[model samples]
Target: MSVQRRKYDPDFKRNAVRLTEDPDRSVQEVATNLGISKDLLYKWRRELRLKEGLAFPGHGKEALTEQEKRIKELEKKLKDAEMERDILKKAVAIFSKAPK
Candidate 1:
């Protein structure tokens, strides 16, 4: 039997990270109260700090920074251009063929 992992939403993660921000509350204390491991809380805090607005994009979704987003857009454009070029090449080849 496999133990299923629990999933927490972005809001819950943000709230947990926020609670650790309190001056009076220790990370261990907060984690204990929340029934989570301190390491997990620390990891969340690190992601929140590093990713900021892009953190916690949830399951099956990517969290891309501004630079990453731009790169993804450019890559998509390149793929489309390459596909069009291939199609045009095939068309030209077919049209250039002499009738039997």
Candidate 2:
């Protein structure tokens, strides 16, 4: 038998982190009340602090900063241009060959 992992939505994670931020509440106290591991809460807090608005991008989704998004777009365009160049080179080579 396997133990299933629990999934928390972005809102729940943000709220949990927010709860941990209360001046009167300890991290362990909030984690215990929320039924999550203290380590998990700490990790969430770290992500929230580090990523700010980009934190908790949800499952199967990536959190990319604006510059990162632009870099990704430019990388894709470069790859496409390189592929097209390769295909054109092959076409030129074939056309330049003498007919048998």
Best by lDDT: 1
Query: Cα lDDT for residue 71, model 1?
Result: 99
What total of clashing residue pairs does each candidate reach? 0, 0
CA lDDT, every prediction?
A: 0.95, 0.94
TM-score of each: 0.70, 0.75
lDDT of 1 by residue, 1-100 (tens): 9998989999999999999999999999999999899999999999999989988999859898779899999999999999999999999999999999
Candidate 2: stretches off by over 4 Å: 65-67, 98-100
For residues 1-100, could you state the per-residue lDDT of candidate 2 as single tens digits? Answer: 9999999999999999889878999999999998989999999999999999999898768899889999999999999999999999999999999998
Error of 1 at 21 (Å): 0.8
As a whole number from 0 to 100, the lDDT of residue 79 in candidate 2 is 100
